[model samples]
Target: MRPRFRRRNVASEGTESLGPSIPDGLWSKCPRCRELIYTREFERNHSVCPRCGYHARLTARQRIALIVDPESFVEWDAGLSPADPLQFVALGEPYPRKVAEAQERSGEREALVTGAATILGVPVGLAVAEFGFLGASMGSVFGEKFARAAERAAVEDRAFIVFASSGGARMHEGVFSLFQLPKTIVAVESLSERRLPFITVLVDPCYGGVTASFATVADLILAEPGAMIGFAGPRVIEQVTRQKLPAGFQSAEFLLQHGMIDAIVPRPRLREELAHYIRLLTNQHSASPVSFVTRQESDR
Candidate 1:
């Protein structure tokens, strides 16, 4: 028999502690394992915890820096911004105002950031969504940019890669937003039509129309560990079906077990793993070891 338990938290009931605050975002607590992680080491480790191997959320710019070869990324459709055709208003802010605020705060015109870049000297079209921007919701601009990225990949004979992180289609856009689902599906279909390899990297909290569409229709679908990937959230699913979901349901690991995803990848190994797959599919030549040293010094 064990002794009766006493609460470890001394804080008052109905209140929560967010842990010790750190300046400049250098320290954080892991949600899964409750381990404290140093941000510098976390970034060096590609936002993965050295202790428990948990993957942390990353911004679009951070991802680009980690994945692409140095100075190789070129922006595509950099000037496009969403329009307020419906003039939506909510929470005392107009739709356009909200869009502007999100853009200013995130430093992106839309949630999606797309471009062409070389992965280990292999040309590929890259699109990464910023979940910091309005939950990375998909709007018409998001779909259009992805279509352009896919088309560019086909034209350049390069592989297409998209890092998907979204809550769903933008609710503020109404039916017009929903239309983007089929539109993006058609764009993804073009990749298949052109016989171009399309890979999707599903980030945390991928769901709704985006997940239901091109996100799942990839030649190879990979997800970061512990990412939430599903059509609807677990709570909604439970509410609708009135059944308890299996433990860890809708997680990237759960999806892999159910044959929904190809594999769970860590951020640090993503570039190498993706390049390996691309080379295998394209029959590209083997790459030399990466080095910035001169040939004479290397031979010596």
Candidate 2:
């Protein structure tokens, strides 16, 4: 005779007495800490997980709002959208349709947004990448927008700032996507020739061509806490090299330790950090000569 076991039913076991199931949109789970947090609280904290301090990804508009002064952001290249130069199709889906879906989801014309804004009242040209749009892949339009943004910085005699949140080059556009690498590098070199300050904030999951080009050419390279920053992801690198990776590989903290980035900044402190560096590099707001020397040394 087998032992009889009763199967308890969660629905019929008076589970409703747990005071109503939590509403879906009211709470968010922290991926790092695995803790439930109030959604409003998470947003107020700039999307950082309170329990474990995981910096969550933000949309371009949200990032802009977080970094710039109130009503100070005036966007550039808003009308420029990517063209399917190769008439690309992937997985039974047309490239244009894929782009349209990304646009609808992100509410942006492209993956990158360039603009002029005041960070803590210091004027600067800003480019923010929207990961919500096709993983913020670099396309011809993305390159164009970035180049124009750098040019605007040169013209305005202001520091240029970029918030890079990308997966890599946009493959849908074919070789045209790869061409953006040199194009954007030329733009960065233009600023370098003019002795203008260029800064980049490497957000979570920044990788591939964007990382290879304009993103890392900035005079000041900053990153959000725990951001994954590398040319190739750990899994890919490990597989190709047939070697094990180190702990915290490609994370912001790891990069900081290796002297690859200037700082690992938390989301809430990012605006202040950017403003501080901008002022130091541009000799604004009475930035001292000592601080300028420190910045130069760090850049080297």
Among the numbered candidates, top lDDT falls to 2
Steric overlap count per candidate: 0, 0
Writing each residue's lDDT as its tens digit, candidate 1 over 1-300 gives 011112123223322464433234545556656665665666688877788887778889999999999999999999889997688998888999999899899999999999999999889999999997888998989989998888888888889999998988898898888999888888876678778789999998898988998898899999998888899877788899999888788889999999999989888899999898888887776757557677668889
User: How well does each candidate superpose onto the true structure, as a TM-score?
Assistant: 0.85, 0.87
In model 1, the Cα lDDT at residue 205 comes to 81
Q: Can you tell me which runs of candidate 2 are displaced by over 4 Å?
A: 1-23, 286-300
lDDT (C-alpha) at residue 70 in model 2? 99
Pull out the clashing pairs in model 2: none
Q: In TM-score terms, which candidate is top? A: 2
How much does each candidate deviate from the true structure in C-alpha RMSD?
8.0, 8.3
Q: What value does the lDDT take at residue 67 in candidate 2?
A: 89
lDDT by residue for model 2 (1-300), tens = 111112233334454653455443556667666676777888899888788897877788988998899999998889999899999988899999999999998899899999999988888899999888999999999999999999888888778999997888899998999999999999877678788889999988899999999888889899988788999977788889999888788888999999999888888998898888877776677543567778899999
